[model samples]
Target: MTTNLTPAKTSANTVSADEGLFKPGSKLKHKKSGGFYRVVMLANIEANLAPAYVYESLQNQNFWIRPQAEMEDGRFELVSE
Candidate 1:
């Protein structure tokens, strides 16, 4: 048997997809699928401390997430739910 693979074409959507909706040092809201989200706190880019704190808090809230890249600026940018 043979399998075929193709590369995805680059487009506006693809380019934008590479960029995050949020930026560093911005606040992010806590969100759950099929539900409303709420602003938790103001995110800061303090040596990657903010994201860790946020992740810990979310963990305490029983939120589960797959492994994701660390925020480039060491902060979380607010995202719309």
Candidate 2:
């Protein structure tokens, strides 16, 4: 877990693993997972990574703390406003 991922922010693949790109009120869709989520909080950067708290189910009002690596591989696409 010694990845030097800090300062490695990027918007590659449209699916962002870069938590810095996610803002509150921003919505994201995972192309592969078919999961749609909305960012509800700012990134909590720890070490070289940040976890973006996002809402996935509106019915449950539940959220998932997604790490930048998962997010990047989540195949997420920003839902344009």
Candidate 3:
């Protein structure tokens, strides 16, 4: 899986600046803090999800699968090994 550390250019001339997963089968974790949620992209999940399908499942509830991890500001590095 690929974590887009850099910004991605879209056809609309815009870049995706969020720290989210760009690959399929990627594990995305979100924690509720204060009034908003913190989204974290786990390592290797990129290998599971296909790039073409990431956006399709982005908003799908059935697709929002997360694992257990320590909570922080909500941002953490993915351990892809």
Candidate 4:
């Protein structure tokens, strides 16, 4: 689980960024809101094709799906704890 408080670490999802970094059991943060979240499931529930993730946040304790591209954009980082 990781949340980057500083803007110095993001690079708009560079090619060298970790694409598979956010998977089930991974922790993340919403940079814009500074809220923490975790990836709970990666369902094959595209319903004919959609993003394949369901996440819950510690701040709100609810589940929702975010665009996979946003994770790739360096908004969610790996928490080094």
| TM-scores of all predicted structures | 0.21, 0.52, 0.21, 0.59
Clashing pairs in 1: none
Q: In terms of TM-score, how similar is model 3 to the real structure? A: 0.21
lDDT of each: 0.32, 0.55, 0.31, 0.57
Candidate 1 C-alpha lDDT tens digits along 1-81? 222322234443232222334332233544333232222222333443223222323323432221224533534445543
Q: Which stretches of candidate 3 lie over 4 Å from their true place?
A: 1-9, 16-22, 33-81
Weakest lDDT window of 10 consecutive positions for candidate 2: 1-10
Q: Which candidate has the highest TM-score of all?
A: 4
Better of 3 and 4 by lDDT: 4
Which RMSD values do the candidates have, in order?
15.6, 9.7, 12.3, 11.0
Compare the candidates by lDDT and give the number of the best one. 4
Q: After superposition, how far is residue 26 of candidate 4 from its true place, in Å?
A: 1.1
Q: Candidate 2 clashing pairs?
A: 17-72
lDDT of 1 at 13: 29
lDDT for model 3, please: 0.31
lDDT for 22 (candidate 3): 31
